[model samples]
Structures are given as C-alpha cells and as structure tokens.
Target: MKHLDINQIKEIIPHRHPFLLVDFIEDYEPGEYAVGYKCVTYREDFFRGHFPQEPVMPGVLTVEALAQVGAVAILSMEENQGKTAYFGAINNCKFKGKIVPGDKVRLETRIIKRKGPMGVGRAEASVDGKIVVSAELTFMVGQAGKND
Candidate 1:
C-alpha cells in the first residue's frame, strides 16, 4: 500500500481547501482505484448548520468525497494529467448509517469501465468497516478550465 500526502493528492486532483474532502490517499493506481480517508471534526463549517443538534455529515457531500477519489484515480493517468472529471450521473446510491464528527470515514473508488472520455466508478464510504454509503458514479473527462 502506497501513501500520498495532501500535497501529492493536490497534484493529481484539482480540489482544494474545504472542498478537498480526501485528507490522505493510502493507495491508488492510475485509472483504477483510490483508497483514502477523511477525519471528521466538529469544527468543520458544515457542522455549524448541517445540524446544530445532530450534525450528521451530508449525504451528498459524502458522495462528492467519493467522486473526488475517482477524480484522483482518473486524473493521475499520464495522458489525462491536469484534466477534470465532471459528474455525469450517479446511480444506485444507498445510505445505511449516519456520519458525525470524530468519525474517520474510509473512501474507496474503483473505475469499473472506461470508454474514451466517459467512465463508471464504484464508490463507497465506510466507518469502522461498516459501509455507510455506496454509489455507482459516471463521469466525463473534460479539459481543464473548460466552461462546460
């Protein structure tokens, strides 16, 4: 298992700051799969209003985190360097448990298929080895800085 710090991850994917959900990537094979983690904290801006009482991690954001992992796997490819993978579709998603502060969420995304500029990835987020979210994500690679 290889490891990539946030700096290395940033070189592969464009996401940054609060939007860069994956804190560290443990292992990833370009155009194949990515394994990463996010350390949830109460100090997060989302917790301030996502719920003052419950503070559950937003489901959509969890999926976005997975997509970011997929982006790393796809963008890390030598030929695809500096490209941006945009969400084309999200299918068959499921949420089984709540994610709150103090949880270290495990994120995994595997590219199941790819044809030209489009591809599909199987993504999931788990905590304590229990899957809390899963989805089949579709994406389209576009040139960096493209408006579309």
Candidate 2:
C-alpha cells in the first residue's frame, strides 16, 4: 500500500482549486491502478444551489473524482510524467446511491488496456462498501511542449 498527499498528487495532475476533488490517495501503482478518497463537506460550493435543503454530491463530479484518480495512476508513470489525461469517453456509468456531505467517496481506477496515448480504465466509487457509481472510462494522454 502506497500513499500520496495533496502536494504529491498535484505533481502528477494539473487540476487545482475547487475543481480538484481527490483528497488523498492511499494505494497507488504507477500505470496500473490507484485508490483515492474525497472528503465531501457542506462547505462545497456546489451545495449552495444544487439543492438548498438536501445537498448531494453531483454524480458527474463523483465520476470526475474517479477520473482524477485514474490520472494519478497514469501520470505517475515515469514516461507519462508531466502529462494530462483527457476524457475520451465514459461508458456503462450507473449511480446507485446518493452521496452527501460527511461521506467519504472512495475512488478506484485500473487500466485495463492501452494503445499509445489512448487507454481504458475500470472505475468505481463507493461509500461504506456500497457501490454508488461505476463506469468504464476512456482517456487520452497528452503532453504539451514548453511553447504550447
């Protein structure tokens, strides 16, 4: 079991501020798989308008958290360092339960296959051992030159 703090995760992926969702990664294997967590809280900006009384973490954001975890795994690789993984497609995504503040959403992603810059990952989000969302995500890794 490996671990990555916020700073270490930032070294791999370029997301920042409110949009960056993953809090910590506990299990990571470069280019293979990773498991991370997001600590949902009432202070989140989206909770303000998503619903005033009953706030729920949006399902799409949950998927994005999973994608960020996937990026951590893929970008941590030596060859893929300083790169960005963009979403190519999302398939078979299903949300089974509601996720609200005070819940910790555990995100896990594993690369199933890859060809050059394109790859597929099996991703899921769970809370208290209950599956909340599952999806097969397609991604394309990109690297920018100093000028670009």
Candidate 3:
C-alpha cells in the first residue's frame, strides 16, 4: 500500500483547485483499492452561492471527488499510467448525508472489474465514519502511448 500527497496526485490526475477535490490520498493498493480525503472549507467557491449563510458541499461535487479518487486509483495501476480515463457512466448513485464546511470527507474506491480499456468500480464518501454518498462508476482508459 502507498500514500499519495497532493503533489503526487496532481501528477496522476488533471484536476486543480475548486475542482481538484481530493486533498490527500490516505492509502492505495495498486490495481485494488484507494482512499483519499477532502477537507471542506468556507472559502470554497461553491459555498458562496450554494448557500451563503449555511454552506454545504454539493452532492455533485461529492460524486466528482469520489470519481477523481477512483481515477487516481485506476491510473496508478502499472498498466494504466499515462492514460486518460473518461467517465462513461454512474450507476446506483445515492447521496445519504450532508457535507458541510469544516468537514473532512474521506473517499474510498475499489476496483470491481477491469477488461481491456474499460473498467468498473465502486466509490464512497464519508465524514467521520459516516457514509455520505456512494456509486458504481464505469470509465474508459485511453493510453497516451496508443496515439503517440
């Protein structure tokens, strides 16, 4: 198992602030599973509009965060690096709780299956051990080497 700091994660995924939701990857097992964190802050751009007085991380962003972590997990596999994984579909997605400012949300992803360029996985978001969201995500991995 390995941990990925923000800088290392930046290398694997093309996401940045306001969009780069994962702050730190806590644990990762190549070709298996990965866990990451997102610390919510009042300064987040969406909070300004989502609700000025009472800010809460939107459900969509929560899902995106999970997806980003999943992407890192899949790409970290030796066979997938330097490849772009495009989200193909999200299935059985459910938002169970609210994520507010000051919350540290943990995202966990597990590879369910991988066949050729397509892969399927399950992801969940939690805060203080409480699940907030979960989904089954499918994506296509396009290797840069292929067209280069």
Estimate TM-scores for all models: 0.97, 0.96, 0.93
* Candidate 2 RMSD computed on C-alpha atoms after optimal superposition onto the true structure: 1.8
Better of 1 and 2 by TM-score: 1
Q: Mind sharing the TM-score for model 1?
A: 0.97
Error of 1 at 4 (Å): 0.7
Total clashes in model 2, counting residue pairs 3 or more apart in sequence or in different chains: 0
- Residue 20 in candidate 2 has what lDDT? 94
Best by lDDT: 1
Q: Quick one: ranking by lDDT, best first? A: 1, 2, 3
Residues 1-148, candidate 3, lDDT per residue (tens digit)? 5889999998898788868999999998876778999999888999989988889889999988998898898888787877877788999999999999999999998989988878888999999999999999898888654642
Candidate that scores best on TM-score: 1
**Poorest lDDT segment (10 consecutive residues) of candidate 1:** 139-148
lDDT of 1 at 137: 100
lDDT of 1: 0.95
Q: After superposition, how far is residue 18 of candidate 3 from its true place, in Å?
A: 2.6
Extract clashing residue pairs from model 2: none
Shift of residue 5 alpha carbon in model 1, Å? 0.5
